[model samples]
Target chain A: MPEVSFVESLRMTLREEMQKDPLVMLIGEDIGRYGGIFGVTKGLLEEFGPYRVRNTPISESAIIGSALGAAMTGIRTIAEIMYIDFTTCAMDQIVNQVAKIRYMSGGKMKIPLVIRTQCGGGRGNAAQHSQSLEALFFHIPGLKVVMPSTPYDARGLLKASIHDDNPVIFIEHKLLYATKGYVPEEEYIIPLGQAEIKKKGREVTIITFSYMVWKTLRAAQQLEKEGVDVEVVDLRTLYPLDLETILQSVRKTNRALIVHEGCRRNGIGAEIACRIQEEAFDYLDAPVERVAAMDVPIPYSEPLEKAVIPDEEDIIQGVKRVLSRN
Target chain B: MKEDHQIWLELYRMMVKIRRFETLTGELFAAGKIPGFIHLSIGQEASSVGVCSTLRPEDYITTTHRGHGHVIAKGGDVKRMFAELMGRSTGYCKGKGGSMHIADFSLGILGANGVVAGGFPIIVGAGLSIKLRGTDQVAVCFFGDGASNRGPFHEALNMASIWKLPILFVCENNQFASTTSFHYSTSVKSVAQRSIAYGIPGRSVDGNDILEVREAALEAVERARKGEGPTLIENRTYRLRGHFEGDPQRYRTKEEVENFLEKDPIKRFQEFLKNEKILNEEMDRQIWQAIDSELTDAIRFAEKSPYPQPMEALRDLYAEDVDPLFQRSLA
Candidate 1:
């Protein structure tokens, strides 16, 4: 096994998929010559040339709409919307056209497309550049939303998403691009809608994903020293959520603490908490707790931004609060 | 290009077929046979038929909400089109997409979009796909003068020009975008003029004349196939009918509608065919009767077709792994 950064894993997976499938192509802003804003698509232009590795103009709607069209016609396209927040410009293409074309066409057309974008609030990039918007796509039907927490998961899930016969919203955490994880020398694919138990315990279950998974793991380690065994469940996919694993974890632990970087109001954590109570209510010894970003725009000030987003302390406090009730 | 007698007769026949089909559609909508609102292309047949006539079955086209003429002219099966409009299982989209979303990929008919300027970007993609595959096939985007004002129009035109993607941007300047006239909404004298900003060749033609429209389409399609990039064509035409069924004639004066009715593409084509000695009164009557019979058979086929089972709504939502998790609660 070779350890690689999340960005490298993505590039490796893209290279392998494009080599294996002639229909696989890349189209987005600065993805060709500039090697992508985050350098995730570096050196691909040299390998694949400009035809397959296309660098499109700064037109979000056209980028997504063209990707949707190409996917429908006969190709697997990965369109990058540099910042996830910029997706608002192409909302109609993603929500109305790409997401509904399969259902609307009655399965006659398939949009094998992956819209890769980065979202998170750790950096002091302010509100527009930093925000977790998986909840928006998760709310839509006919779309598979995948958020990987590690390099191994990112590479595998992205390969799977590319081959999927449906549109996928593959959201990357801006902060997780440099995170290193062990990826196999051989190719592998982590199926979407599957949860991974990063660390298992018996006292409480901390459910999180993407960057929040790292925070929860750190908090879980601190809790281990204090003799509180906290189980961490990293939801690799948001929609088609791995509810069975979540319910099983909650059943074993008898307490659930949902953590996410998105605002607390109507966030993905809220849905998880609701489902935990609805399906596993009897298994809970205490009410389900949620640790999420404060309901405010990500501030420009570093301290204010840090204060708004969930941290390890918040996850630890949330777990202790749930444990205190029991 | 000089069209022969056979080509002129074929054009006339197609124009008559589209006119009769649209008229019957209006009648069916009034009789409560169709479920949704229908945008009839009563006066825009020449533009659709003429442009489609120049392309092969492998060439692609993206149409607007008012896209019945385009689909029919592009060799779509009349029965399946009627079935789709009637919400039957035998329809092109299995009744899931009613009037605004009919498509036949085998005939290279990309789905009609409900958005005003939706077809622009999709056509760019189709053109891009053609370029990537190293094929000479071209993609045509049929939109209105109103759609030219949209962001996608700018984005698609600029992208297609810089990349030199093989696409034909056909703007059916039918004088109205819904109830608003082009004069009120558009800044330019003609939509084709905007093509200059993107560094593409732009031309305007008499959309009612089938031969003229066909000639212009031939040049553009040939240029696209030669990898000369996209061309903007402004077909100066009008919508004789109201934007949608049940729309009162409050937007435009009745005189304006009557004036456009005088320039009806079908009648003009019939006159041209007559002058060219290709079609006589007897032949015109026979063609009308044949088209009427064909439309009647299509309606009967649609009426006899089955409605999709209610459970079908859940199907086709995903291609694989129908996710029993969501279906369990619904069941």
Candidate 2:
């Protein structure tokens, strides 16, 4: 295993998949000669040729629609939406068309397309760019939503998503691209919907995903020093959530704290909390404490933004609250 | 003359199949057997048949809400299409896509769009793929005159023109966006005129006249195959029925609808075939009979098909191989 950046892992996964299947191609804004906005597709254009590494117009609708066309036509298209917030421009294509195509046609047509985009707060991206809309996609039955926390998970899960028959939405956090992690060389796939136990413990189970997973791990480390052992569970995929793993972790700890970057109301954490109370009620000693962004839209100001989104301190406080309930 | 006769007979066959399909769809819709809105392609049969006839199975066709005609003309499986409308498990989309979103890529017909001008940008992308891959395939985007005002139409045409993508922008000027006539929404007299801004060849043909539409589409398809970039074609047609089934036509005169109905595409094409002395009435009758039988069989198949099972509702929602979330349970 080599220490690779999260973006490199993503690139490696794409490179390998593109080589394996000629039908696999890249489509998105700035994905061609200029590489991606974040350089995740850097050097891929030259490696795969212009036909394979396509740079689509700024129209998100076109990018997504074209991806659907290609996917339906037996091409596996990995289309980038630039940023998750820009998804608003192409919601009709995403929701009404791509998500519905497979089910509507009675499985006669399946869009084997992967829509890759960057999400979550951190880049001073303000309200539009910083929001986490995994829950919105989760509500859509036909879509598979995957959000990986580590380079290894990012590469493996993305590789699996590319080869899958149905449409998969891969959401990457803006700040996690540079984060380094151990990723094994050669091809691998981290199956979607399976929760990864980043660290094992007993005092409390911290359930989080995306960038918050890293924050939760940091809180776990700090708590360990305080003799309060905490278990951190990273939900890499949101839609087909691994409730069994979550409940198993909750059963082991008897206390649970749900955390996510999205708004608390109807957020991913809220869904997890409800599920825990439904299935893991007997295991929970205290109520499931959720560490989530406030109900208000993500603001631009640094302090206001910090106040809205979850941080390590928030996770720490949530952990303490869960333990104090005992 | 014999060659012309054969083509005319084939065209007639396509018309009969589409007509029967559309009529059956209307009946099914009334019976509540079809899900979602069904935009009948009854009057615009010639426009779809003419354009799709000029393209290959590999060549692409993007459709609008009025898409059954295009699908049939492009050789899509009618039974599957009807099954889709009925939301059956055997439908092309496994019952997910109802009447408004039928698609068959094997026949080169892209999915029908529910959004106005939604197929415009996609056709450009398909053309980009064809041209980039050096394939002779060309993409045809079928939209209504109302879609001309949509942002995707302008964006796609402009980009396709600039990039020299092999796309045929076919605007079926049905004259109405639901209730509003094209004249009311569009600033331009002819939607074809907008092609001048993109610097691509632009032409307007009588949509009801099958020969004229075929000639226009043939030239555009040839030009696209020759790497001459995209062409904008405005086929001026009319909507005989209301926008949807229940729409009360307060906007347009009944006389206008009646007048357009008088020049029925199948009738006009049949008359043209007769005047050219290429095909006899007997041959036309035989072709129509075969298509009608086919349509009847398709309807029967759809009626017998079962609705998608509730347990399988989650299946194919995401691509089976890549969707990591669903497979997590297996692990």
Candidate 3:
């Protein structure tokens, strides 16, 4: 086992996948000589050459659309949109074309595509770049949304996503790139739609994913000092949702608190909270609580941006509120 | 243009098949036999048949909403198309995709896109695939003047050009984007002119003339197969029918419709074939009769085919072999 940065895990996985399967290729803006904006695809172009690792124009629609078309044929394409916010430029391609072609074609088309992009705040990138928009893709039926919290999860999930027959939205958090974790030298596969219990506790359950998983873990530690036990469940895959794991945790803890970086209004929290109440309503000691970003654009100023997004303190407060009930 | 008599007659026959098939589809829609709305390529047969005649079955094509003609020309089965339109299980999309979405990947027909410029990016991808696989196959995208104004159009053309991908951006300038005419919507006088910015060879032709359309398409296809890159061709044509069946069509006057009706592509091709002594009145009548009987059988097949079970909707959204957890969630 070796400790690898989150970005290395993804780069190594992509390189291995491309080596294992000749059909795998990468295409996006500044992914070639300039490397990816996040440097996850830094040396891929040189190793794979230009044909396999293409540097495309500043055309998001074409990048996604062409990826869909190539995937319809035999190629497995990993298309990179620079930011999750810019996915709107290719919304029709992702929402309508990529999502529906397999169904529309009646299983005649096999789309082995992974849309790789980064999303998150705390860098003060402002409204256009910092918002978490996975909910938009999560709402689409045909897409599989994967958000990994650690380098280990990122490596395994990305390898699985590359080989998956359907289209997958492989979203990465910008802040998670530098985080280091031990990844096994041997190949491993973390199947999508599975939740991991990051920490074990008894009183309350904190359900979160991606970068928020780290925040929730820290919050859990902080609460432990005050004689509060908090359980953390990191949802690796958002779409299939791993509701069974969530229910089991809620049942044990007798309370649930959903935390996410996306806005509280119609965010991932809302869905998780509704599902918990719907399925595990009888097991609850308190109503499912949500701690998420304010329903406002992420501002550029540090304090303003901090005010907009949820932090460890917010998760702690949310858990206390859930425990304080009754 | 120098195609032999049999090739010319075959082109003429395909044009008639498309024209008659579209006419039958219109009738079926009017009779309430078809469920959803349909956009017919009645007058734009020359562009479809002519361009498709230049490619092999392995070559790819992505067409617009008014794509029945392209599908039929690219060797799509009328029985399956009608079955799809009738929402039967045996259709191309197994009733999942109606008139707006029909595809047969076996023939390299990447599905007909319902969005205005949706096929542009897909076709570019097909071209990229051909280049990556070291195949000489070419991908053609048939869109309208209305589609050329969309964002995908700009992105697709630019990307295809920089990569030198083998694609043909065939614009069936049917003069209407639904009710909005290209005259009001399009900034350029000709859609082909925009190709200049992409550094590709582009030309506009009389879309009603099968010979002219074929000649331009042959050159473009040849260029693509040779790995020279993409070409943009604007087939200046018209939508003799409304954008969709049951459209009130208040945008254009009756006189305008009547004016274009006289320049119908099928009629013009018939005249050209007759002038070349390739098709006489008897041959022409026989062609129509053959197409009519074929369409009759196709409609009957569509009518007799079973409708898919309602539960079938949950299937095919992803591959059957996906995680059972995802499948369970779908239900």
Best by lDDT: 3
Off-target runs (Cα >4 Å) in candidate 3 are: B1-3, B321-326, B329-331
Q: Which ten residues in a row have the lowest lDDT in candidate 2 chain B?
A: B322-331
- Interface quality of candidate 3 as DockQ: 0.80
Worst 10 residues of 3 chain B by lDDT: B321-330
Model 2 spans > 4 angstroms off: B31-36, B83-95, B131-133, B279-290, B304-312, B319-331
lDDT per residue as tens, model 1, B1-331? 2557788788888988999999999999999999889999989999999999999999999999999999999998999999999999999899999889999899999889988898887888887788778889999999988899999999999999999999999999999989898998999899999999999999999999888999999999999999988999989999998899899969889888888888998888887778977788898999999999999999999999999998777777777737434523333
Ranking by lDDT: 3, 1, 2
Residue clash pairs of candidate 1: none
TM-score of chain A of each: 0.98, 0.97, 0.99
Q: For each prediction, how big is the interface RMSD?
A: 1.5, 2.9, 1.3
Best model per DockQ: 3
For candidate 1, what is the TM-score?
Answer: 0.98
TM for every model, in the order presented, reads 0.98, 0.93, 0.98
Winner by lDDT between candidate 2 and candidate 1? 1
Docking quality level of the chain pair in candidate 1:
medium
lDDT for each residue of candidate 3 in A202-266, tens digit (9 for 90 to 100)? 99989999999999998888999999998999999997689999999999999999989999899
Candidate number with the higher DockQ (1 or 3): 3
Quantify all predictions' global Cα lDDT against the true fold. 0.90, 0.84, 0.92
